[model samples]
Target: MLAIVSVTSPIFLLIALGFAAVRAGWIPREGALAMGRYALSFALPALLFNTLSQRPLDQIIVPAFLFAYVGGSLIAYALGLTAAAVARRTHPLDNAFFGMGVSMSNSGYLGYALISQILGAEALIAVAMSILTEVLLILPLTLILAELHDRRGRHGLARTLGKVVFQVVRNPIMLAIAAGLLFAALGWRLPALLGRTVDMLAGSAAAVALFAIGGTLAGQRLQHGLGPALAIAAGKLLIHPAAVLLMLFLVPAFDPTLTQAALILSGLPMVTIFPLLAQRYGLGELCASALLITTLLSFFTLNLGLWILGS
Candidate 1:
């Protein structure tokens, strides 16, 4: 519909602009990386903190929505891992990375930008909740699986688990979420000046993050690994959303907006760090190709998803 386009077009345009800028050499590769780092470390954390801190404790946690979203993601992850294990039958680490490609959603950058614009600031609670689930549960699980596959029992299970826990706690996004939730629970409010400063940083997150995503895509090689990449893309763009829909149906009562938000977020491409994580396991080529393919394909798929929801 025109209304949907009106809401989504600018967000895509910003992404396109970033893509073009990078492709045309308007922004150097290093600059794009720096921009992405800034968004991830500062802008996004500030935005999450601002949004979560101001919200009531109850609003920050939605059991039904979290259950549906996390359940769907786990199902998709399991399916992808099974398919990869069966098809390759040699590299368990690769299978774990493949599963990651299928399961992780680019919620922080693409999903947040789109949902905030389309659904407004109040809808951010859903986005935050999804991000929390990703940071806390899905990401660590996949990383541990991949690490275990790589180590092959050489490393002690306790040590591996401890390392993953440390990494998660040290993550700025997770720390920000924890801080925000604590403030909300304690009924603390930011001073007027500090609140305005946080808002200023948060306001820049969407555009910069999208632009960085575009640039990141521009930097990836998209020709190789087409076969497996396409399969992973299908899992991300189609199967993930379908899983979310199924879980939503299973949940007896849920916030309709949160349900819709979960679907949209599920339909997004894998998180921007997919390739970086894959690089550690030497699966970068496949994951990068899949990320690019899914991200480019998501415009049409997301539009279709929105249409389906509207109808």
Candidate 2:
């Protein structure tokens, strides 16, 4: 528990401090957005390429891990939607963001740090699992849900899915993952110079992204709608993990590492992308508030999981 706190608290504090500095005008907000774009477009792709290309195929290709992780995420989506219905949330975009807040996690930045600290370097494979599931699987579904719920016009659904496909195709990280997998399958390796270049950029992605995530949340409008945001946060940090554990129990895998990792990862705070996706799809307020609340509350839930697992 102490180890979990020791590792996660400092990272979040640094993020919070960055947000506070930005909010106070010590760091220009525009500059932070620029940093975020660089991280997403350049640094993150490099990181994904470096990580995926070098990781063992067995780790990345585990069927059981995929089943547990992806299944857990789907269950989270259903649970979030159900909870929103019970709460009488009728706004389509808000509910979509609410559902995203439940299923999506800060897998790359926050998950990597916490899992590595608690579970060692081996945990990177689990992070890889999360990235693959999130980027390839859950993200597309969220976009589809957003479109179906969109009532802007008759063509809104087409526009929503079209933009989603375009963005997915354009995503550097997704491209890197696809390229790296192909290379891995064909047993090809990048030149040492290119590999080193990737390493340099990849090293900077996590911390920068975390800081930007904090800055993004610092500017949120959490004051207006507390109930739905907390409801979403509860689903993300608490209910999601519980659902994953239940799934794991029902399946009863021979090895527990993947199951354990998936459950813990599911319990994490909403990803920084929540607000971005919400803004793009029109659920900015809900996404922003959920991001802030979950980020703050994850300390307790994460530590509790660590205590249970690490014990």
Candidate 3:
């Protein structure tokens, strides 16, 4: 229990401080968006490359963990959409936002911290996979859903595929993953100067991200759609983890390290990025509020999930 609090509290405290700063005008509101861009475009990708390139590909590609993480996300996304439709009277954009809020987690940030505390650095491969699943697989689908919601002129199936391809190509995390894989395949290592530089930048990612998340929470207000926001939070903290555990039986066993990693990753609350997506794409206030709610509730839910797994 102390381990949990020790790790989780510092991260949350930074977030809380960031939020208070934003509220008190100590930090400009615009700074959060810029920090977010740095996280998405540079820092996170550097971290992904450093982490994954160091892992043994054969051992890291655990089919069971993949199934649990990816399959659970798909199920949770669908359930969130269905719940939104039935309970919130939300429009397509709203539905997509709520679904994303529930299904997409802060896996890379929170997962790294929690798993490192309870598991260890050797579990880093599982954390890398968690990030890959969340950033690569789940994120694109959510973007497509948002596009579909906005009626962004689907030229054809091929065109839609092309756009997704373009988006993937443009995504820094995907690019880093691809580059890392290529280097790994060739048994290449980064030069010392470049590698150390990347290591330094990557190390700053979690702290900046947590601070930005808090700033985001400070900026959020439930200007509309409380019902959907609450529903999204419930889906994230409750249904998503439940889906993961339910699917765990169908999959093969991961190593204990990976198993613990998966549990912690799966139970993370909504990513701080969701609200940025909502605001950028015109999804609306409920989306951000949903994110805030899920993040705040995650302290309890993550502890419960870890206890269940450990027991």
Model 1 agreement with the true structure over 1-311: per-residue lDDT tens digits: 77887888888888889889989999997788889999999999999998899988998899989899999999998889899889867488878877778888999999899888777888898888889878888889888887787844545678879999999999988988999999999999889999898899899999999999988888899756588999999999988889888999988787777778999999999999999888887778888899999988998888888888988
Which candidate number would show the highest TM-score if scored against the true structure? 1
Please provide, for model 3 over 37-83, each residue's C-alpha lDDT reduced to its tens digit, 9 standing for 90 to 100.
78768887887788777766675567888889888888998888877
Q: What's the residue-level lDDT of 168 in candidate 1?
A: 96
Global lDDT of each model? 0.88, 0.76, 0.77
Q: Order candidates by TM-score, high to low.
A: 1, 3, 2
| Candidate 2: residue pairs that collide | none
Lowest summed lDDT over 10 consecutive residues: which window, candidate 3?
Answer: 151-160
Candidate 3 residue pairs in backbone clash = none
What would the per-residue lDDT of candidate 2 be over residues 1-311, giving only the tens digit for each residue? 67667867877786887789799988887777777788878887776676667766665667777777778888888778777766775776556666678988888777776666666666567777788888877788777777777667434677768887897887787888787777777778888898788889988887887787777666777754888788888899988888777777666474566566787789999878787777766667767877888888887888887778878
Candidate 3 ranges with C-alpha deviation above 4 Å: 151-155
RMSD of each: 1.4, 2.1, 2.0
Judged by lDDT, which candidate is best?
1
- Candidate 1 residue pairs in clash (backbone atoms < 3 Å): none
Lowest summed lDDT over 10 consecutive residues: which window, candidate 2?
Answer: 250-259
